[model samples]
Target chain A: MGATEMREPSFLILTALAGGPLHGYAVIAEVAQMSQGRVRLRAGTLYAALERLAAEGLVASSGEQVVDGRLRRYFRLTDEGEQALTLEARRLRENADRAVARLRTARSRVAPA
Target chain B: MTAGPEAAYRRLLRAYPASWRRRHADAVLGTLLDQADAEGRSAVSVADVRDILGHGLLARLHLLLDVVPGRVRAVAGTAALGSGAGLCLALLLLGEWLPPWAPPSTREAGFGPFLTVGPLLYAAWLLAVAASLLRHPRLARSLLGAATLAAVVLPHVVANAYPYAGVERPSSTALAPLAVLGLLVLAAPPSRPSPAVVAATAIGTVAAVGGPMLPLWLSGGSPFPVRDFFYYAYAHHLAVSAAVLLAAGLLAAVAALVARRPAYAGGALLALLPWAVLLLAVWRRISTQGMSALEPLVVVAGVGAALAVLGGLRALGVRVRL
Candidate 1:
């Protein structure tokens, strides 16, 4: 299956990765912001998803930092996550185009009246 | 706020299963701290903490249900028993409610005939229990039933008919019988009911009896009626007797199932012997006092007869059904 078949968290995490490599907390914040404040990932859930994605060779963790005396681990999407995200974006664009075409046809008919 | 929010978060975390904590607790804690900081708050509100904790607990609860072994979860039954015993003791202590049929003569304060007869009957009960536990572990389930009989059921049997001395002491005597029952459980090896038989018998026997008795009991009715006071205490007696008999029968069935295992035979023996002795003693006590005084001797005779019949039937190559 293509990248569009990936889960919502993987999709959002890939979208967050578009900004660049981010630590666990930063990734969670960026995902929420990108989703228009709709998706807030708990650290536990995020780490769990990260662990799975890393195991699947789609994401990799790199370089930990000590911030406020707590360890913060950074994560970066691999070539696989990027390729998957590209496929998903293409699928979304195709679907959006079809819907927009249908809307334009309907709007042209309504405009005459 | 340092201690307060941490304490509040810890309190919320308690809902998570210990196993889940061992695996992912630090990560969850890190998340909570991050969220609080992102919101620019030194302390998380109780409601937010509760929401987070509730989600964690919900996940743990599902894990507990799906992943934990039934035996590990069954230990909660012991806690339930402890709570139930505590509640009963508390209620008994708090309420001065006398037995509806407490004859005026039961309170001869100083132990009279009851001291001698009670202990002996208890001993006989203990013996039978040990025997049953030895011969068939399934019968040991009746140990509690026998204790209940001796403590609750038999007293009602006697109390129903006669003007007994120190009737006021039955509730006090309750602890001894309950102790005897607990000891019997301890003396026996770990006894597990066969799942198939336990499920069938529990539904058929325990539920059959307890299902109705519970409603009656909750409504403040007597469980076992003193026979002579039967009219007034019928509902109570019926409920108590049903619970006692049903319990005894279920235990007996369980003991029988366990008896098939040779390893537990010795413990089962220790458990049964005392029970039998108590039963015989009870038979003796009740027989000696009332028209039922002949009852204990008659039971001894009947048991002998049953044995004789078994022997006779065995000699004739006939299998007699109990």
Candidate 2:
């Protein structure tokens, strides 16, 4: 979609990596859990996002390893990425606050206030 | 504990690029193993293997796309270079082989010498291709086309200009076209980047023993050397030049690995190696006796090419301090 709508998944991905470096599968799992299972990521979709972020110099590759006969790669967010993530989170919180106030006002009117 | 699963995992890992694997393959595998251990012995299944394979492939593909810009249509220039190179190679082969097989009249009429058409044409073609490359740039095809065209024309020009008649194959004359060709070899497009990787287990395969095999079929030279202008001036010269280029290419590739910047490494090796080798040869000749008559013009051309590249890069907004 537009730039305004594109920030959600990126922010979520960065947040998932913020705790520490995480492999592809771990990042997907962590993000889903952190979002209360509201944001399950497909392998294609998650890696696609990871690639874009890496190109932008946001997320850097930490390392890779094999466990249980599967290859995995770990990534960590850069300082610039962390700052951008912080800004996005704040912007989102502000918007959410405005929506909650608007909903409250609408409920009062519906209650005959 | 299980060798079969580990081997399978390593095979799956091989799908990624070597550079990427160098950085992360081990960590990734370790994490996978940790997860498996946490799940216990009965945890493994076919689906898990499929998921691993699918994810590894996706990861590698994503990495490949990272080298180019995200805009699909805009990046078509690189794609054009690749195709152009292939077409040029095919054309080069046809130009080289078809002339011998042609009627004597056709050969006399310059059908055989038509291979020379490419180099002159390439000067214009390369400019256009480079413009297209830097502008909408077909990443691989444009370069490949230019190189193939150069290969055809350049060798023929050298052959015609200085017949390296048998027993008197002048080293100086023989090195000219090759030196020129070597400068442009790495810039010529490559086949698409390979995705093969190696896993942590099964000895990890960091060892191999094989020399760079010459492109024999493509060369198609007769077993015995000929004293004719065709063999001396053209064939031998081309063969030597190609071999030198092959050496320079290996040097460039190694430099790329060391530098961690493929483009810079390739450019450095291609531009410097030939000039260095030629410069040394020229210096040695001048020290022994006197400079060759063509030295002045060669120097001028070399300087001019450098300036042209500088100007082009400047116009494209790439700053060149020197």
Give the best candidate by lDDT.
1
After superposing candidate 2 on the true structure, give the runs of residues whose Cα lies further than 4 Å from its correct spot: A1-9, A20-29, A37-51, A61-75, B15-19, B40-322
- Point out where model 1 deviates above 4 Å: A1-10, A42-57, B1-3, B17-23, B46-51, B58-322
Candidate 1, residues B10-127: lDDT per residue as tens digits?
A: 6677767787677555555656666777877787665565566666766665564433223322322222122223223322322222343444443333234332234433443344
Candidate 1 local Cα displacement, residue A25, angstroms: 2.1
- Distance from true position, residue B193, model 1, in Å? 39
Residues A1-113 of candidate 2: C-alpha lDDT, one tens digit per residue: 11233356677899988999988778867887888988766444566588678877889988766654566778999997887777777778998999999999999889953
Prediction 2 TM-score vs. true: 0.36
lDDT value, residue B116 of candidate 2: 38
The DockQ scores of all candidates, in the order shown, are 0.08, 0.12
Candidate 2 residue B149 Cα shift, in angstroms, is 35
Looking at every candidate separately, what fraction of the true A–B Cα contacts under 8 Å does it contain?
0.15, 0.24
